[model samples]
Every structure is written in C-alpha cells, then in structure tokens.
Target: MPFVQEALDGIEFARGDPNSTWGSVRAAMGHPEPFTLKYVAIGNEDCWKPHYRENYLKFYAAIRKAYPDIKMISNCDGSNAQLDHPADMYDFHIYQNANTVFSMANTFDRTSRVGPKAFVSEYAVTGDDAGRGSLLAALAEAAFLIGLEKNSDIVEMASYAPLFVNTNDRRWNPDAIVFDSSQAYGTPSYWMQHFFSDSNGATLLKSTLQANSSNSLEASAILFQNPMDKGNYMRIKVVNFGSSPVDLKIVIDGFDRKLLDSSGSKTVLSSTNVKDENSFANPEKVVAQVSPVKSLVEKTGTNMDLVLLPHSLTCFDVLMKSDITQITADDDSHVSSM
Candidate 1:
C-alpha cells in the first residue's frame, strides 16, 4: 500500500500544481510548470498474475481519489472480454508472424464496445517474416494500422513496440529504428508509420473496396489539414500484402471534383522483394518514394486508376481547395480494380 501511495504521490508532483508538496520540490528544481502526465498503467502485462488484481485495486483507488481526471490503464486485455475491474483504458499487446499480424487487423471489429477503450501499447510483426525489419513485416503492420484507423472509436491509442535497437546490444529480433555509436537508420517499419502521420484529428471518410483480391488488401481514407501549409487534403492509404499486382480504380464522391488540385502526390514504400530489409550499408534500399500524382496516374480527378505493386503500401494525397477544410464524404466512394 505504501509503495502504491508513493507512486501516486510521484505522479501528483509531476502533474499537480506548484503549491503541492511534490510540485514544490519540482518547482525548486527550476521548473515551475507541471508536466503533461495524464495516463498511467498500473503494471506492464501483469494481468494474469494472482496478485495483480488485488494490487491494482489499491493503486486505482488511491489515484482516483487523488486525481480524478487522470486516465488509469489496466494491464488486462479487454478486447475479447470485459474486465472485472474498472479502467479508463485496457492494454492490448500483439507480436506475431507476418500473416497473423496482418489478419489480426480485424481483431477489434466485434469487440464489446461497452467496456474500457483499448490501448495497443505494444505490437509488432516478429519471427522469420520480420527478419530485422523486413518490408513484408511493415506491409502487414500497415494493414493492421489501417484496421485500427477504421476502428478508432473503440481504440483510444496504438503504438509500435521496440522502437529503437542499438547494434551493440542486438537483443530484439526486429525494431523500427536501428542505431549504433554514430550512424542510425530507419527500418521498413519506421517508414511505414509515416503514412499515418496525418491521422491525428483527421476526419475519416467512408471507403469501400470491391475486388477479387480484396482479402490481401486493406485501405482507409481520411481528410486532414497539414500543419505546415494549412492545406486541407484527402489521403487514401492502401496496403497490398500479396505477390501479384493490382489495378485499382478509385472513385471519390461527395465533393466537387473541380476542387481537387491536379498537383497531388503519391507515395509508395516497396522493393523488388517482399522480404527485403534495410541496413546501415543500404538504409535507402527499402525507403518510400514520393512522386507527383500525374507521374503515376493518368488522371487526378474524382476517378483515377492506380497499379498497386505487390507487398507495398501506397498513400495518395489529393489537395483540396484552400477555402474548404471540413466536408462530409458521400457513401458512393468505392475501391475497384478493372
């Protein structure tokens, strides 16, 4: 009980007012403002242990009484079942092979929405398929992220695990970023994350796909404002996790086709082989390539056809008119391959 109390006390010092005891100590160290600490997990993946629930209750009660606004996270996974105890969010972790990771994109589709929101704190494509961050692993993870984006209402947060690995201590099988004493480079998984960078606060658009190879494809569309240029753009992200190429025809509706700028962009992350990986010697071997939409697609209006490469992740950004920032999408947009 004392240990738990002390931990909560530490949190109060970190985020509480400067007049508080712990806050006073922090202020005395030349930092007067409180830190932004809003969420705290009771423990890491300790839900199965016998004493986890008992100790969790103590910590939960103490923190709730002290800080009602702080979101408390439980170690238990509430995706498949409801948790017996109360929590603002529940932990969900997954580390599997490429196929399993990709197929698990719909893992939360049918989850009970009455329980606490899910926090996917740790997830990665591991084993032989993810040899030191291969492109195959990244493609599967991208598909999984697309699913999460589609289910954003039930999922509160999600993050990739093993973010950085030092070559000196090569313990983990695959990581997003690899570094050493001096040089550092991002793996395919790291590049994969850039496709979703504009997702925060973005409005998701209704999108559907009808194709023979739909099983090997995952996609989502969103409208977001670029913080730098203050430009409103619609991004359609797709992941093809198969060997054959796909000719996809995108038909966007609900907005003025004339409003879309012809100078859009298409970014793709792929290589000659699906299992290709990036290393210090060849960091750019599997990096994403950015090109003008006109260079890749014949047309840039509401209807366009794109040839998606195998085991690739593609993002198409269509710039909207400067005056328009918020607009609802119609239900007629569909993904089809001709």
Candidate 2:
C-alpha cells in the first residue's frame, strides 16, 4: 500500500503545478511544464489473480480521493458483464487467431450502453496465422477495427499490441514495426493503421453491405475533412476476408443529386498473397497503393458499383462538393451515404 501511494504521489507530482513539491523537482531538472497524463490503470491483466479485487479497492479508493479527475481503469473486462467494482473505464484485451479477431469486430455490439466504457488497450492477431506480420493478419485486424468504428460509442479506445520489435532480438513475433540498428520498416499491420488515421474526430456515416450469401465482408464509412486541403471527403473502408471477390453496389442516400466530383482517389492495402510479409530486403511488397477513382463523377443520387478484391482492405475516398454538417435518417429505412 505504501509503495502504491508513493507511486501515485510521484505521478501526481509529475503532472502537478511547478510550485508543488515533486513538481519543483521536475522543474529543477530543466522542464517546467507538466505532462498530460489523464488515464491510469490499477494493474494489468490481474483481475483473476488472488486478492486482486481487495488490493484494487484500496488502490482505487486512494487514487479516487487524491485525483478524482483522472480516469481510473480496472483490469476486469466489462464487455459482456457488468463490473461489480467502480471504474471510470475497464480494460479489455484480446489476442486471438485471424478469423476470431475478424469476427470479433462486433464484440461490443450488444454491450450495455449504461456502464463504464471499454478501453481495449491491447489487441492483436496472433499465432500461426500472423507469422511475423502477414497481409492476412492485417486484413482481419482492419475488419475488426471497422467494427470498433461502428461501435465507437461504447469503446473508448483501442490499440494494436507489440508495436515495435527489434529485428536482431525478436522476443515477440508479429509486431507492427520492425527495426534494426540502421534501418526500419513497417509490416502490413503497421500500414493498415493508416486507413484509420482520419477517424479520430471524423463523423461516422451510416453504411451497409447487402450481400446475398457471403458473410466475409465488413465495411464502414466516415466523413472527414482534409487537414491540408480543408475539403470534406467521404471514405468508405471495406475488408473482404474471403477468397472470393465481391461486386458491391454503393448507394448514397440523402445526398445531392450531382454532389460527387470526378476527382476522387482510391487507396488499397493488399498484396499478391495473403501470407505475404515485409522484410528489410522487400519493404514495399505489401503496402497501400493509391490510385485515382475515374468512375466517380457527377452521378445521380450516388449510385456506384465497386469491385472489392478478395482478402484485401480498400478505401474509396470521394471528395464532397459541399460541407455536410448534419444528416437525418429516413423514417421507412435507414439510408447510408457513400
């Protein structure tokens, strides 16, 4: 208990005012500004251990009293069940096979909206399917992330585990970035993160995949503004986990009849083979390819047919002519805009 208190005190001092006790020490070390530390976890993956709840309560009470504004995270997963203890948020971790991880995109679909939000602090596609970071693993993780985007209300945060690994001594396999003393390169999983870079504050648009028989398709749409050009764009990200190609028809409802311009781009993150990986010798083997979308023009009510590649993650970025600040759903059926 003493040790935990001391640790908490130090953390508080680090983020405290420069006039405070430990903040003075930090200032004397040449830095005066406090670090932005808002979230803290009681313990990592220790909810099932003996006496974890007892010790956790003590720590929680102390922290709650000292720093009430800081969001405390509990290790217990409250996704499927309500937590007995109090927490601002709960930690959720998953390390599973490709198929399972892909299907788990809807893992939080049925979670209660009244409880603490979930912090998926750790997640990855592991085992033989994710051998040293393969395209297959990246595709599955992308699909899962699309699910998270659809359920972002309940999921406060999510991240890929084992971010960087040294090539010389790889204690953990399938890391996102691989590094050596001289050079560095990103795996397919690392490049996959680029697909969601614009999703932080973007507005999620309603999207649906009307397939007859295939259950291997997952997709989501978002409306985001380009920081550079200051133009609004609609990005439709889709992941096809099966081997068969899909001819998907994208219909944008509640959109202007001639709003879409011909100047649009399509970005795809895929490779020739599913299990293909990137090494120092061939870093660009499995990377995202950007191309112009020639088919999209001043279409009528935004009706377009898209061919999704098998086992690939594709993003169709269509530039919007006007800024869409708000959208209301139709009464009869929920309409999705591409």
Candidate 3:
C-alpha cells in the first residue's frame, strides 16, 4: 500500500487527479493491507468549492466500487439534499451559551424516527472570554454531557472540537482544552470529561432525583445490582450548589436488607476567592475530601444533613448489609468513611 496518493494512483481511473493522489498517499503510509477504513469525508469547509462536488462524487464512486463496506460522507450546506445521493453520516455543530446547552437536551426529545445518527462533533460555550474557557464552562459541559448520556441511544458519537490551542498563537476563538509551552493544564470544561469518564458505571440504571428546587439542592440515586448478590445496592450522587448546607433525608423503598450502611463524601472545587483555579504551580488547589457523616441509630433508614460546599460534587455509596442476622443490633458495625 502506497500512501493515499499512491493508492489513488493505483486506481487506473484516478491517475491524473491531485486530490485523489493525496488520498492514496494517506492510505499507503498508514497501512500496508487495503485499509478497512469505514468512513471518508470530502472537503471540510471547502466542500462548496466549484470542483469539490465532482471530485467528491468521483472519489465516492471509486471507493464504493472498490470497497462497498466503506461509507462516504460529504459536507453540504442547507438542510435539503438530493434524495438519491448516498451519505452515511451527517455532521452538526453547536456553539451556544449555557442556556442553549441546557435546552438542547430536549431539542430532539420529540424526534420520531431514527435514521443516520447525529454527530455534534464541535461544541462549546461561546461569547464572553471571562466565562468562555473558565471552570464554569466545565460545569456546563458536564451538564450537557448528562444530556448526551441520556440521549446516547440516538447519538452515535460526539467530539469536542478545536480541542487544543496555544494561548500565545491561538487562531480560533477558544479551545476547550488549552495549554502553553512547558505546561499542560485542563480547563473547567476538561474536568467535565474526567468527571464523566471516571464516574461512568457498568450500567445506566433507571433512577430519579428529588429536589426541592433546581437551584438549591439536587440529588440523583442510581441502583447498581450486584452480580453476586440477589439484592441490589444504591449509589447516591448529590450536588449542592447553594451557599448553605442541605439536610438530605433518603428513604429507599422496595428492598429487604439486614445491613444498611451509608457513607457521605464531598469533593469541593470551589475557592475562597471565586476566581481561583488549579494551575501547574499549585496542583492541589481544588480537591475532594472524605468527611464523616452522622449515622442514623434506632432507625431502619438513613438520615444526615450533608454539608455540601458551594459549587461542589459529592458522591455517596450505600452497601446493604448482606447478612443482617449474623450480627447483633447492639454490636457496633464499623462504617467505612469515604
């Protein structure tokens, strides 16, 4: 396999085309065998060029004849397309503010039919450099991702684009993850990626949250069924963004358990000064801490007033006592602090 250019040159029909030659050379240097690439796009923003459509069709037809499994994707302006023209994927970009990002979760909620999956390949908080690449943006990104996770059955894949930019030599508006020479640091948006990636559970369980008000307190409960145990357990994630502490009284119904143990933990990402951020100089500026939560005695359920710091993420795991009969009620069951 020559590169993309050579592969295109090897095609007797595409010998004289420069763009075809480029694609051929791309394939050759990367792979020896006929590349099993599934998707290929023609032009990017330049799809509207005068010769681009014809060139795209030529490559598409050639690739289709050569490998039917490969799918051709083309960037086209406007909503309408030739019904007979073939395309396997459609790309859509979004760069709205926080309000719009919050509303987008329900944008396709009424979508009736499923066809080609949508790729939100590029998205970010636009406008206001003050909040553009700040930690608040990361919190918004996390909220947006919660929507994506809810709609993953429809969305095939999504990527945050304009991913990196040198602060001194920025060509675009702003990159989601940015760093300068000698130091690589993640923005608030970057933390959203880590939070989602690190906290993804084995399964997306059907759970619900009970909140007094959307602004003050919000809590989510996810039931994780243990493979070894016939009974299931619960993991509660509570976020208190308010200035005051919230007293969370949780009662889980429809489960039998002899041992019910619950521990609360808090991860504070806030600072005494609202504008503080973790940099290479002081890496541990914002971190999570494990504090002892008050236990409920003489009761079957758990109750505690969780002092969640303002603008913080807290995770709590509850393990049901497997063999309640083995221990005496007077016996002190050691609760592991998170």
**Which RMSD values do the candidates have, in order?**
3.8, 2.9, 9.5
Error of 3 at 275 (Å): 5.5
Which candidate do you rate higher for lDDT, 2 or 3?
2
TM, every model: 0.91, 0.93, 0.61
Better of 1 and 2 by lDDT: 1
TM-score winner: 2
Judge candidate 1 against the unseen true structure and give its global Cα lDDT, from 0 to 1. Answer: 0.85
lDDT of 2 by residue, 1-338 (tens): 79677867788677978888888888888889998889989899999999888888998888888888889999999999999999999999988999999999899889998889888888889999999999999999998888888778778788899999999999987999999999999999999999988887777766567664248988887778888888888888889898888888666555553555667899998778999999999998999999997666554236666788888999988887777564443332222211
Off by over 4 Å in 3: 1-36, 41-65, 71-87, 129-132, 198-202, 215-338
lDDT of 3 by residue, 1-338 (tens): 22444444444222223335444554455632343456666557655578766666677677677757655566653223332345665555677765456456544445433455445567776655214355444444445555555445444456776788786786765465557877766655555454344223322333344344455444444444445544444444554445555545544433333345543233444445323455556644544445544353224354433445555556555555554234332222121110
User: Which clashing pairs does model 1 show?
Assistant: none
Position 296, candidate 1: lDDT = 30
lDDT of each: 0.85, 0.83, 0.49
At residue 153, give the lDDT of candidate 2: 76
How would the candidate models be sorted by TM-score, starting from the highest?
A: 2, 1, 3
lDDT of 3: 0.49
